[model samples]
Target: MDLGIAGLRVVVTAGASGIGLEIARAFAKEGARVVVCDVDAPALDALDSGLAGHVCDVSDRAAVDRFMHAALADLGGLDVLVNNAGIAGPTGRVDQIAPEDWDRTLAVDITGHFNVTRLAVPALKASANPSIIGLSSAAGRFGFPLRSPYAASKWAVVGFIKSLAMELGEFGIRANAILPGAVDGPRIRSVFEHKARERNQSVEEVQAQVLATTSLKRLIPPQHLATVAVFLASPLGASISGQAISVDGDTQMLV
Candidate 1:
């Protein structure tokens, strides 16, 4: 099927590894000109051929503008912006969370979304088909006790997308969010590691507990999420606007 995304100029933040890298790969495979940005220089260096990337700290607004402008210039024009850069801040109850951790989480997971989108909106408006894709989490739709900060950051992303969708719809642009659960990765393992240490359980125990909630009983592949993202950016997904779709394996039973 023609996704109508071939030859489109696209930017994917945090495309060095994990889900972000998978998203970038999907677009590259579909023949789109992909520009990736990430803090991991080594990962950027290891990207597949034809994929251009730059070292960028999404937390830094100045670096974001410079990277986006350079990449856009190289790609000729930008039509899709994937705000996939994020961090899982320290796990703790609201009362136990430190102010510093909260601020850092908000900066990258939330403000980083704003920084890139704020810079990319102009180019998006100019495109015939413009789309903004955010990688939110199932936590974005609900609250979990030990993840107040991370939950807040993801929730903020949903609000950001909804408001931006309304404001940019006049300019023929669409915004959407993907909420995934337990995507198999080392980063996810770290999330459980922290939890295990905090709650006095082995990492195996935490992983088992979380996996039990998923009806599918397996880890979600980044490729699955990447496929969905590609569809959203294509003409096939023109009507999928301002919606947060869950990519979880029934891990989150959203209302």
Candidate 2:
């Protein structure tokens, strides 16, 4: 089905790899002019999307401002903003986590979204159909053991989007968050390994236990999120806002 977002200008953070990259590609496929930013300069340069890429650290307000200028200049305006840049953060007990680690995690996972969305607001207001899609996680809904920093940050993202929906709705802009659970990728493998070590279980066992929480008992792919991103930015999602949609095969909880 045509999403009716062709020619729209979209910006995706950390779009050089993983879920972010897939979201950018999905927008490009939908005929939207896409711009992506990542701190990984080499990865940004190597991206095959043929769209504009910038080296940006979303946690840095100045860097985000610069990126917004460049991206807005390239696209003339913005229709969609995908705040997808995030870190897995330290996986350990809260008491074991360093103060710096907690601060850094919150900066990237939560503050980064604020930086980008603040800069993108003006351009978004000018669009006929503006949308802001944020990346949260299933951990945002349920607490995760040994993942306090990550969980806290992801939960903050949900709050941010909810507030943004109310603030931007007056301007005809929509805001929502996507909560993914145990996505299939290197990142999740790393997470599973950490959980295994922490729980004294095998990686396979830890992964199975995590999957068992979901009705599908499967790991979701980055593309699953990409599809949702596309749908949320399209006309079909015209009235959808302030919703925290989970793409985790119907996650029941986190164990």
Candidate 3:
């Protein structure tokens, strides 16, 4: 199905690895002119998808603005902006969480999105079908007990997208957030390990408990979320805005 995304100019933050990398590949596969940014210089250099890559730290406003100018010039204009940069944040009880850790999490997860979106809006407005896709988490919907910082940041993403959708709707710019649950990756494995240590359970036990919350009883592939992101950037998702779409396998809760 022609998703109608071909030739579109796209930029994805933190797109050198993990879910962001997969999303960048998806857009490139659909013939979009993709530009990706990451703090990992080696990963950016090694990206084999034939898309543009830049070293960018999304949490830094000046760095984000620099990336925006370069990316927009490379692609000539922008049709989509994928806000996928974030950290797992410190895993600990509220009292145990360090002040610096909380600040860092919010900096990357929430302010990072702001840094990118505000700069990309002007270019997005130039496109006939513009989109802003945020990578939120299931924790945004279901509060995570031991992951207060992560949950708070993700919930802020949802709120950000909603407000953006309303503000940009008249300009034909669609804004949406995707909520992923238990995606299979090193990142998630690390999260499970942290949860296990926090709960005083084995890693296997933590994994089992997490899977039990999903009706599918399996980890979601990063490609699944990538596919949805591409769809949202396509004409097929023309009217999908201000919505938090879950790509989880019917996850019941975060606990």
Candidate No. with top lDDT: 3
lDDT of each: 0.90, 0.93, 0.94
Q: Write the per-residue lDDT of candidate 3 for residues 177-243, one digit (tens) a residue.
A: 9999999999999988888887899999999999999999999999999999999999999989999
Clashes of 1: 0
Per-residue error at 49 for model 2, in Å?
A: 3.8
Residue 116 of model 2: what lDDT?
A: 94
State the lDDT of candidate 2 residue by residue for 50-83, as single tens digits.
6789999999999999999999999999999999
- The digit string of per-residue lDDT tens for model 1 on 1-255 reads 878788998999999899999999999989899999999999998988888999998889889989988987998888999999999887767898899999999999999999999989988989998999999999998886778888899999999999989999999899999999889999988888888897799998888888888889777998999999999999999988999999988885321
Scored by lDDT, model 3 comes in at: 0.94
Listed per candidate, the RMSD to the true structure in angstroms reads: 1.8, 1.0, 1.0
Per-residue error (Å), model 3, residue 25: 0.3
Q: Is candidate 1 or candidate 2 better by lDDT?
A: 2
2 or 3, which is superior by lDDT? 3
Worst 10 residues of 3 by lDDT: 190-199
TM-score of each candidate structure, all chains considered together: 0.96, 0.97, 0.98
Cα lDDT over the full model 1 = 0.90
